[model samples]
Target: MKDTVMGTLSQRLEENQIQLNQLLGKSTDLVTKELQLDSSTHIALVYIDGLVDTQVLHNSILYSLQEGAIQDQFKDLDPFQKLELLRKRILIAGDLSVTHDFKQFVHQLMSGNVMVLVDGTADALRIGLPGWEDRNVSEPNSQSVVRGPMEGFTENMRTNTALIRRKIKDSQLWLETFQIGKVTQTSVSIMYLTHIASPDLVQEVKSRLGKIDTDSILESGYIEEFIQDKAATPFPTIYNSDRPDTIAAGILEGKVAILVDGTPFVLLVPTFFVSFFQSSEDYYQRSDISTLLRFIRFLSFFITLFAPSFYVAVTTYHQEMIPTSLVISLAAQRESVPFPAFVEALLMELTYEILREAGVRIPKNVGQAISIVGTLVIGQAAVSAGLISSAMVIIVSITAISSFVIPESGMAVAARIIRFALIGLAGFMGLYGILFGVFLIILHLASLRSFGMPYMSPIAPYRSSDLKDSIFRFPWPLLKTRPSNNKIQDLKRQDTSKREGSAYDREK
Candidate 1:
């Protein structure tokens, strides 16, 4: 029975039921309803329990089919014609389709669609009635903002796409969907502005997505790993955000967004290195304030990436870089500590990372208490026991706080991992090693590409027109063009107009 392949529905009703039961392993959720059609013919409705809405199934399908009008309509028709009549006129389900392929019918049935089979018909009617519990849309836990829209994406794919649609209600905002993951069959959607997005980049993204042959794509992270350009690099070539406004902004900027089912986070492609430092709030604030915040973020990024490494380099190798008084103070503090500068920094950084991970993985109620206790006990005990220096603790704490200033978590994670490498290099050769490491990182970033767009756009290649929105965003009036790196079809984002009484004279 397991080896038997299902074919066209047999004239015998019992055989069809047996085959369906065998295919579904006779699961308890496999519900079958037998309804008599007049005195001669019968129909079997098969659907999974807890998947379909019972009210919809009863009112739209069962009630309509059990009516005397439907029985009269099907009384004289043959089984094949009766199936067509039921699908076309009798079934009240909004989404109705007919399929003769046994495999397709089974798949549809599993996907929360009711399959209708008549005794002598070779075809089956698939009625869409998917009803599954899902979480309500709420504020994003990861990317909260003070000035942006509070609504975040939900796990439902349709709802997520609809959220984007609500923001940019343009027909040009196109969505192309694909089903990846052979086993999970996760629905993946690629969204872009058809006129603004580059066709070549879009095609490249599509090609990459089509090439994914994984067994499961449980989250956007899985797709990110499969499609990213520099898989070995710690820096994320692709950006992901749970905020719909963020994804919409990416689309309007000629980037493509991939929305994976079952996850709120959506991936944005053709992302530049500078983009990770930006937040949606940047656009909401005054340009001057935004520019200031942007500069602060860049400064924080440098501090996070190089603070520990620079400490190791200066304390262990080049004591002259710091003031003589501060150097004396740091040395006096570390006099009782037995570990080297590298070991001390590494131990404190690893301890912070462990606490951070535990806070994230543990339950919400107990996580804060654990993290507070762990940090207090570890920091205080380490300093008192001379396992690490007080200065090292302060440096590590500052570095950790600076890491939180970066807007994107993936880029922050890359910085965190790279911080250890930089620290190791600094320990080896002091300031020269740190400079060498920074040079290599810059070179690697310049060489990287995301969907054919340079990772370090508007800076490495030096597009002055696009730089207005890079490190420091110019006023909206001065910013009238889209990013040149994208090479989109429609370049001019908005028309520029000269102010009547501006400082500079208006040219004809």
Candidate 2:
């Protein structure tokens, strides 16, 4: 615990703030250690530097002190009234503050505000100082869907929430705040629909969040693992996103969203396995186009999952299934490599992984000129250098690109990890091993549940109505009923019978 100071600056910093920073390993530069006192006013302007808007802060705090607004507000009213009115109207653009105590004042300043104090004043008035000190919103590099809203979430939590809020525009949308980490004390918000969302699910999510015991929460992934239901599965239970429309859609569908400060990724719980294939673009466009795109995504998904394994199986055990020409070409390509086909594939994969890591680790911001876009040349060079076979390079490149095509990056990573397992299985017993491995993966997915709803819903539980929206989307008019499992109250999507009858009469 930080030592609580009664009424002194030197005393407070020496006891509370320094100890707290040391405990937390916080940046000393962010902590504003300042002291100023006039004849009737002594003040401590403790704030996180760079986060405050200097112009607004100087206008509010220093200008108020010079103008004597603090003393003037206190002249007619009681001590409490002065603090309240000044903070309500004169200082804060709104009434976000409930108290004018030292602790509350400091907290507000840390969150971006200017604090004003007088020597004789009992409490401090926090001036509204919202700073625009963050990177501009940019296109999401990870979950880039071609036909959806181009806006993406940023590291700033408030900006991220605002982007989603713009999409929702409903009063029933609720945001509950909490601080998770002991030292970091990072801000986290849980967003959900109050009326439409399941009460049990909301409470369950809150219960899990409250149970977390951690010193710092730096990313949504940290909260994801802590709150997730355990069954020793490698696949992620939480759906992580960098798009606000996707999160807003999730909130509308009765899922709880967790947004942590300082990371673009947000976590949505009770996410179905089908959601990994679904994109924000799926809902924004015409139903026919949506259906076609959805089907293509599904094909890409299965291709990513089974392509390498199928290739291995056909080359090794199921050689009869391959065309004679392909076999001759692949055989000719592999003849130079002393290693087996499987070994060659493994070597290429490892080499690609190293190059991918190198690309990320070499920070472009720090003047590193290395670009991964020349990957084709690198692969060609590798083959020419006799480090890998041409067939292996092609296979590795295709697999990597296929994995990228999966909309949900978490699932893409899951596919990558599972692909390796499938490769191992294929190398062992070819077709049989590959089948056994895929079967296990399917079984695991079927058994997994998100907030008591099976991960593979509509397929595992078999709901025909929900299937219209899942796997492959059907025509919007044909989807006359809401997804049954979603349990939406406004279920009648369209009057399909009336439309069909009118169309028949017109034709006649």
Candidate 3:
């Protein structure tokens, strides 16, 4: 069986069918139709049902092969000549390739291409006729924006690549594709700007992908887990988004994008800690508004991370930090509660987390309603029952709302998980523990790298040029250089001297 797999195809069509059958087993969806071109010549059309376009197979291969004097002309020519005639004259396929190895042909067949096998020929023709139903490009539920392109990536890899290509039309915008999964044979593509992206970075990305030895790649998340720099860390080293504009912007900044087949999410490599806070909409809006929104996202990040812990630390150990009136109010609120400040905050946070998860897992039509109503009812009931304090509920609610302010869900999730640990620390060792946890988090982030680039870049390492777009996005004309963190080949993004209105224009 191993020798046969490595060997080239045979001139006998029946034996080829046996080899394919042995390899593919008795799959009910695998369609094999034999065509008698003439009295002497026979050919087989093999493809997976529901994958290939049946209409095209009927009109192009079936009708064209059986219709005219085309069959009569095949009698005089040899098998090789006959196959050439079918390819050059008969088939109306836009893309087709000829292959001798059975393994290659089978891969193409499973990929929705129709395989043509001739009786006296050693090679087969694989015709491109992929046609399967997929969701139309719709607004990305994950990364929706008030202003920007509404068309998100579909599950179809080609459609996703085309969407990015539509934005960046330069020849330097190149894409390379390879199959990763052994059993699934999923097609994964890496896209980058040829002239702007560093050669070393592109090679490193390809090397990591090529090193992935897995049997199945079901989605982009599978690849993300496999190729990420640090698996143990809660923070996502690689960024993923369904928005093409976001992906295009990343590629423009010399980052590589990994697009997996059958998934809408595309992974961007060398993603900095600050990248998660930034959104594609930031570029669409004015610089000042974008800067203000970015500051809010950063502020929300800190609030989500430290709000509950801060409240816990102060209420549990350092009551002097709060005003006399506020402290008296908090004491009154907690007078009926049996649990300590730590337990009360923990219960409320856990309840909110459960409700938030339920909102995600449940049906979309009622998920939001369920989460909102469930939280309110549960919180009010818990307060009435004296199980949790009102102050704890307010803190949990503020933390939950702040988590949503983050643009990237991956980062938001990381912050949410870390918030629990910080809350636990605050419960045990007061403000000191929360401070220690934060210090350790910063150290961990500083040590982490995303494909050789620092996870916390431009800020920790202090690249003045790249800082223009890190925490605060500078004006469009002022952002004249690409991000220096990627070690990009091309440093200058735009020639500011060509601007219609600027200091450069005034000098001109």
Candidate 4:
């Protein structure tokens, strides 16, 4: 059947019913309950079986339609008037919409809404009683904080948006919704502060989302990959968080947040390189503690990216650079191993990666224990069999631990990939190769852009004002302005002139 047949509904409910059934392909879950209101009026309630609230349908809507009191009012009213009367006074559903198109009726029916078709009316009422099973709001698994809001986003987009609203609670906070995915017709929404986020940024984000022509958007990650500034780069140009407070904070800082249905992770745009190391907990804790943790994260980034490669480079080409005794000890440990430093390190790293992947794929109850035991046993056995050196094991272990210290898994994964590339470079050209790799990495970071903002914002572009919250967060009283890199309209974050106490009285 052509869409034209279902595009416009007839005055007769029977024709509309046939067209709706044709559009729906008469699916197994398509439910239709026929009801008679007095002598002249007839209505059909169409909805998917599992998607709608059966309790609401049976207790409120059906009971009201079948009530003797309402039957007297419907006797003299026309079909359209009857629908109007039901919509204005009788329907007990919390949310309702009227639509004239059959296509919209099918869409609403698919989205877990009940559609009511009157016998002689063209307009139908769409009841919002969606009752799909969803996971309750829970603590985030990937990004947990020692001190901050414990609640995280749920898979439902409406629930996620509510969580953000609860955090910000400002009138300027706005949300724009889009139905992407040609087939799935997934609900996607972008939220930002009207006064804080730049108008151009908002329009640009809408433009990118409009241009996407995919058939399905299953998760927020799908939108991220499609709309990111650069697709080929290992470093993520877009940042995502499962915590609502983190997203709300981003919105307050002039970043737009993308929320997709069926996903807990919400994406924040115009992310800078330093953002990967920063956490929501940083703002919750004292400035000094956040600064220390921030410094440690930066240190961990370097260690995770360079530890194994640096070890390989030094042992292969700069053994003299090490202390004399340590060099002798390292050399003695490696003497029994058959492979060269690079090969040995590569084998150990690959083994660790395998074990790490296995731990994630296995049952959660024993995953961590299995991975740890597997690593220890494999490392000791490799050394005992002279297949690898003890020094290489220590380097790999340190590198693994350091990688976990980075807050963002995406950034940590990027470092891991670059680590392997650096290891290969060291295997061929030693320390000089490592230096060359680092230079290239820095150059790439400098060139990268996240939605037209520099990836290495405060560092590469050298914004002094923004640096207050970048690598080391300055005190709340001292930090009075929002990040300048975002070019937001509202720059003042707090009133610096009103100091609360003499405890922060270091400067005039």
Report the error of model 4 at residue 379, Å.
0.9
Better of 1 and 2 by TM-score: 1
Report the lDDT tens digits of candidate 4 across residue range 172-247: 8898999998778899999999999999999999999999998999999899989998888999899999999999
lDDT of 1 at 446: 86
- Give the worst 10-residue stretch by lDDT in candidate 3: 499-508
RMSD of 3: 1.7
- Compute each candidate's TM-score over C-alphas: 0.94, 0.83, 0.97, 0.97
Model 1: ten consecutive residues of lowest lDDT: 499-508
Per-prediction tally of clashes: 0, 2, 0, 0
Q: How much lDDT does candidate 2 score?
A: 0.71
Q: Write the per-residue lDDT of candidate 1 for residues 437-492, one digit (tens) a residue.
A: 99999889989998778889899889988998999987776677888888888878
**Weakest lDDT window of 10 consecutive positions for candidate 2:** 5-14
- Candidate 3 clash pair list: none
Alpha-carbon RMSD to native, per candidate: 2.5, 4.6, 1.7, 1.5
Compared with the true structure, all predictions reach lDDT values of 0.86, 0.71, 0.90, 0.90
Candidate 3 structure quality by residue, lDDT tens digits, 55-136: 9889867988888688678878999888888888888774877999877887888899999999999999989999999899
Q: Could you tell me how far off, in angstroms, the CA of residue 365 lies in candidate 3 after the best superposition? A: 2.6
Off by over 4 Å in 1: 1-15, 365-373, 497-508
Off by over 4 Å in 4: 1-6, 500-508
